[model samples]
Target: MKPSGSLLKIISEDLMPVTEIDIRALAEIYAEENVYLSVYLPVSRENEHVNRVFVNSRVGAIKKVLPADLRPEFEKTFDMAEELLFEPAVSGERGRIIFASAPDSFLHVYRLAVEPEKSLVLDTSPFLLPLARLRADYEDYGMLLVDSREARFVCIRSDIAEEKKHLSTDLMKKHKKGGWSQMRFNHLRKEAIKSFFSEVVENVQGTCDELQTRGLVIAGPGEAKQELMDLLSQDVRQSVLGVIDVAMDISRDELVEESDSVLHENELSTSKKKADELKNAILKGGLAVAGVEDVRNALEQARVNVLLIVKGSSVPGWICERCQNLQANTRPPEQCDRCGGPTSSVNIVEELYELAQRTGAEVEFIEQRDFLDSDDAVGALLRY
Candidate 1:
């Protein structure tokens, strides 16, 4: 029997791979942790991307497969593993397996991701092509923030969301006394919002043109966003999905959490609101509507792109004489796989197990400890 999704995972025991790989051709490979595992799967989406996607910033070495001459050794590596391969709906010259890991089944979910850049530059997109075409590929959508004194735009992967302004910052840089200082800082904030949006128009619009999508978000603090809406070309504004009301101190990190907190209060960044919705859905057993039955159906159809289940909820299906919670089955014929208990006395009832059984899914269980604490993990993405 295939192991539960909980059994397969990948964790970076070497957290400094970025710096190490960038500085050295290949950093010393570390032994895999007991909790970590990795896989390769077919690629989807774009066939062209940047070469530097996964090279640690310091090592500067892009991920490259064994040269053509090394095919003999490469095939040997695959033969050594207990493996299975599924082609699914791949249409490109290459395919990719998504490598994800969870700590103890759920606490921290690790996605195969390209590191974010500090500049409003979408440098990572160009790097995904070769990487995905090779074995050590890591590509996934992400967000970017573009700012100018007059506008601000938040590009989520490709779709563009913007906020622009003509707020007068020209008035405040003079006095550090009294209300004047407070007034000046507010003006700087307002001007920054405007400039951010202008850059968004130049960046996100140029990237997603070929992709058919809409409802991109535009957000940030102050009246600049309202001003940006007024300035968008009719063609651009029509694609906007939401404008939130939130603000944050400038951030150095480009992850969604840092930028999102500021925009959560605005009418532009809806990350928080959508996160709440997904959480509500998951809690309502929406994720396990048919439990294993639904999963079985999905597996048969090969429609399961991602399958998630809460961890530690796994239990055998034996009727325990002491507690009548679960009906017992196979009273004594089989051996227990996990606890070595008599198979007849225990019953299996993990929500994920049933889900996995039904779906033939490559599973990833989030241990209670690894559960994503934020909505970003499950939030419905808004695109424009």
Candidate 2:
């Protein structure tokens, strides 16, 4: 993950928010001999006791099933997990995740603002489905709060909102003079307002681009918000999900709360719109492919632009040991079809996720399983 920058301050330097880079790095990690212990638990103050009990029971059960030689190492990782979770610094976090490997003496802890589903997985690689979902749900976005005289730009990422820039420009005040002077003053006041708005728009675009925000939300009291919207370039305007009417003096917490609704609505609408597009493409046999095998092929050829998969979907599959090619299969195969290399068992959905990341394809997790009507529970909108 990228290092924390000056734009925001995290709860702690050690406990940073998960990023796409972190996910990609985790996906690449694998243990050839010793397994990695991945644990997710609700760490909210009220759940402390329950967290301890759950971890103890889960660890004991897994230890019983493990080979005698591996039990000691497994216990070591479990101990590390417990220590990290119970640290006083972890109390306020709504959730916590620990990835530990005893043999490698590796331990990584991440704090979550939102509670994740409680899960423990012992595997060759870290369990990343939860992290993937969290990243998708809380992608970075920009919030612009503006009035005729001032503008504030805030970047919201992983549930943390930080004000990045504040801009203000002076405007000519209303005068009580007679016709000629009054008209001239009105003309100058309008010019000043336009100039201020133009400056605000420039900064809005620059800040959003610098932050690489995924979406934008504009808010203001009256015509200022609409006026700023009108001044934005088409590219920046397209990134704006919606606008809100609010006073300039609104508190940061209130602004975030208001923008939350807009962000949530945008997510739902965007997902539905993409689903419809996928459906149409499939009906016409145009640029979409559904089912695991076809989607895998499209991804392998780098033809996929957007990959759609039902949330929590998985299938028994194989990954070629030599080629790393993913194939979904119910039955085991001795060798890979393409490279004639030995294959290893894997979860097809997870492998598909990694493949999509490797190919720079955007992944959309469909919450409604029946949206695509495919048994494989996966589809792709292709570039070809």
Q: What do the candidate models score in CA lDDT, each in turn?
A: 0.33, 0.77
Candidate 2 Cα outliers beyond 4 Å, as residue runs: 1-15, 90-92, 170-184, 300-302, 316-346, 369-375
lDDT tens string, model 2, 121-229?
7765677877787777787789999998999998876666779999987685645556457667778888899999999888888888898888899998989989888
Each candidate's root-mean-square deviation in Å? 17.3, 4.7
For candidate 1, the per-residue lDDT at 295 reads 40
Backbone clashes for every candidate come to 83, 0
Query: Once superposed on the true structure, which residue ranges of model 1 sit more than 4 Å away at CA?
Result: 1-199, 207-217, 229-249, 253-289, 301-384
Give the Cα-based TM-score of candidate 2 against the true structure. Answer: 0.84
State the displacement of the C-alpha of residue 220, model 1, in Å, after optimal TM-score superposition.
Answer: 3.0
Candidate 1 per-residue lDDT, tens place, 259-301, comes to 3433333322333333344356557745332243344344335
Quote the lDDT for 345 in model 2: 73
What's the lDDT of the predicted structure labeled candidate 1?
0.33
After aligning candidate 1 to the native by TM-score, how far in Å is the CA of 251 from where it should be? 2.7
